[model samples]
Target: MIRRDLLLTLFGIGAGQAILLAVMPFLARAYGPAAFGSYAVIVAVAGIVATIAALRFDLALSGAEDASIVPLSRAGLLLPLLTVPFAIAVLALALRLPFGAHLPFRSDDLSLIGLIALFQGWVLLGSALSTRRGLFATLAAAKIVQPLVFAFTALLLLHDLSLAMAVGWAAAMAATLPAWRHLPSSMGWAETRATMRRLWRFPAISAPMALLDVLALSLPLLVFAGAYGERTAGNYAQVQRLIGAPLVLVATAGGQTFLKHAGDRLRAGVSVLPLIRRFVMVMLALAAVVTVAVALVGQPALTFVVGPGWRTDTGFLLLALLPVLCRVIASPVSHILVLTQRLATQGLWQISYFLATAGVLAIAPRLFGLEGTLGALACSEFLLYGAYLVLAVRAARAANPLPALSSKTRPLSASS
Candidate 1:
């Protein structure tokens, strides 16, 4: 079942991501690094806010019941609405203040940026609502719809590049309307507020982890813009997005599969150690093959597809990926922390990682430049992920009271 769900998710998400990837070259041509850099920052901010706005109530969808879903999603849905307006106010005021210039957005961009954040929260709500109803296909379809709309809308809005990115985000989220329909009717303001109080731990604990996790991606873009320049931020954003394409696809599939199985296996006293170890090994080997192939033809390929202007030196690219490489290994293992009910521990690690990465990206660049900073960030991530894997394995071992693996234990293969 784990393998099957993973394969289906991969295929569905892979198809959608492929279309998104296909349109990126055109979007890249339409918006240069500086413009795209600003767009990246906007998108990143919206995404970060959206993740927190949901308060990870979306995460409780799979195990939660109908009575639980409404109030949770209602609270999540209301968050961005209330917060975005305040955020816009703060951003507007900030732009008038001394540190305003340091921000990634313009005064004109603030309202749309806030709206984008609001829409992203909607997307999160839709996903949770859909998942609660077991509408995985709807989730998958929405993934595909988002990028196509983004690419199409981006081309049409070439005159206003930043606006294009913002609208594209909104459009993508809107495209998944059906998924949101699965959300149960609101349980009234009083009941919803009560539920929020009930699930305070999600906000207190998982929300921080979610925020830290997002900051891991957003902080770098913000720092790159601040430390280097808009162009450098754009360049950094480009590399992260391009490289992450394949990595995230696999990670998303692995995550869903891991969550799906980890619960059942834990309840059954089954060992996931062998499975986790095998998953890591398989990923490493796959990463090696992909890395080698990309190294051999990456430059030419980028030039041919994305154009020569977007190309960076092969050696420079290779040296840029301490964080990226760490993510490759760690992303799959992330679900384990959740499976083991280790949100507090995971949040601490996330806090440490965000601080470490931000510190390195900020200070290391002055001493060792881009490569050194990336390397430091990557090394920190490697250590964090290593500890997470260890904890996950320990938890798995603790839960496995069964004598040993038997024929009843289904392998990750299909034949069984």
Candidate 2:
């Protein structure tokens, strides 16, 4: 079941990402590093906003009961409306403030950022609802629709890159309308409050983890822009995006599958150790392959695809490889922490990771220059992910009880 579902998702998402990847060279030529850099920051901010927009109640969709689904869906739907507006206002204000002035994009991009974040939340809601219903095909189709729409809209709106992203996200959200239709038109505030109480961990614990996780990912782009410059940020953004595409594709598909399966296994009193082991091994092997391929061809490939003006180099790829591979291995399986009810431990790790990332980015750049900074960041992430994997394994082991021993459970005899 996992293999089948993962393949369907991978195929659909792979195709969509392929389309996005195909047009990227052309887009790079049209927009150049500066614009792409700004777009990366906008997208990063939108991602952080989207993570909180629904307050992460959507995560509760894993194996939710029918009695609980409507209110959860409603919470997922309406929370974004309230949260996104407030977030957008805050972001807009930040853009006007002195420190925000360090960011490359103008305040004009705020509207696009808000739209993208809102729709992205809706898209996440849809994904959650669909996964609950086992609607993998629908999810896969939506995945394809997003990047395909983004590619076309990006070309058409070459004059405004951020707007194109907003349009693309909106289209992706539209594709999930069928899933959203499953949501109740209304839920009483009392019911909503009760439901939130019942699943309080998602909001109180998982939400913070989700936010910190995204911030950790986005810090490099944000820090690079402020400390380095738009051009350097853009160059980093281009390489990061390229490295991230396949990782996202696999993680999304595999994470959804594992989330559902692990939840089921836990509910049935089955240990998820074997499942976790399998997933971690597969992802590790995949990451190793990616690291090797990138080590060999990464620099030349970037130069050929993105053109000479961007200054693609082997040093950046080498410095980035360790972190990227570690992330690929650790991220998809990290959800095991949540499934095993280890959110607090996971939260601590996330907070530590974000702080460490900020500290390293702040200090490393001063001493090591660009490559050294990246190397430092990579090494820190290597340690962070190493710790996270250990936590996840321990949490998974602790979630299941030890088997009982009895005369009936004795080892098989030679003739038995």
Candidate 3:
């Protein structure tokens, strides 16, 4: 079942990656580094907002029962819709702040961030519900539609990268229209309140955990834009996009599958350790293969895809590989924390992750320059995520303790 679900999810991710890879060359040629940099900033801000827009109630939907799913899904949708105006207001005001002058995008792009967040929230809710309901095909379709729409709109709106990205995100949400039909007509205030209370841990714990995780990812882009320049940030962003596509694919497929199966095992009183162990092995093998392949052909491929004069440096790619690989490994089975009700432990880790990311980004650049800073960031994260994997294993064991050995089962002698 896990294999089948993973392949279905991978099918969609594969399609989306193909679309993105096909159009990247055109996008690189048409849009300058400065433009790409600004677009990256827009995405970064929108990503952070979207992470919290639903207060992570969407995650709760994954393990919800049939009768409870509708109300939870409805509440998830409503939260983001309600957040839209607040997001716009806060972002608009932020752009006028003194530090706002250091922001990468112009004032006009602030609204796009809100739009992107709203749409992303919709997609998030849809995906969780779809995964819970075993609608991998629908989930896959949504993935394909997002990149397809983004690619087409991006080509058309070559003049406006931010707007094009927002449009593409909007399309992803639109593709989830079918999924929304599965929601309640309207959750009552009492129902919404009750649901929120019941799932309080998600918003209180999971939301912040998710927000911190995204911020860790987004910090480098924002810092790069402010500290380096748009062109430099753009170059870095492009390298990330290229290297991250496959990671996203593997993470998404593995995560969705694990969420479904692991949740089942936890409910059935089965040990989740075996599943977690399998995922770790798969991710490690994949990371090793990807790192070697990219080392071999990443630079030439980047040059061919995005053209010359745009700093498609292999040094950055190589430095980014280790950290990204660590991330991909942890991300797939990280849900074990949630399934095992280890939110507090997960929260502590995420907080440490965010702080470490900020510190490294702030100080490392000054000491070692861009390449050296990336190397530092990569090494720090390797340790952090390595620790996280250990925690995951412990959490799995704690949640599902091993049975005691029977007296008949004697240990074998070393000589034997």
| TM-score of each candidate structure, all chains considered together | 0.86, 0.92, 0.93
Q: lDDT tens digits, residues 268-308, model 1?
A: 66777877886778678866776785688766765555664
Please write out the lDDT profile of model 3 over residues 158-197, one tens digit for every residue.
5677777778778878777777675556547787677677
TM-score of candidate 1 versus the correct structure, residues matched by position: 0.86
Q: Which prediction has more favorable lDDT, 1 or 2?
A: 2
Which scores greater on lDDT, model 1 or model 3? Answer: 3
Candidate 1 lDDT trough over 10 residues, lowest sum:
407-416
| lDDT, model 1, position 28 | 77
lDDT of 2 at 262: 79
Highest TM-score, which number?
Answer: 3
Q: Which model scores highest in lDDT?
A: 3
Question: Tens digits of per-residue lDDT for model 2 on 133-203?
Answer: 77888888889998888778878755767788888888888887787665656657688778788677778
Query: What residue runs in model 2 are displaced by over 4 Å at the alpha carbon?
Result: 96-98, 184-189, 400-416
Each candidate's clash count: 2, 0, 0
Candidate 1: give the clashing pairs.
322-378, 323-378
Compared with the true structure, the alpha-carbon lDDT of candidate 2 equals 0.80
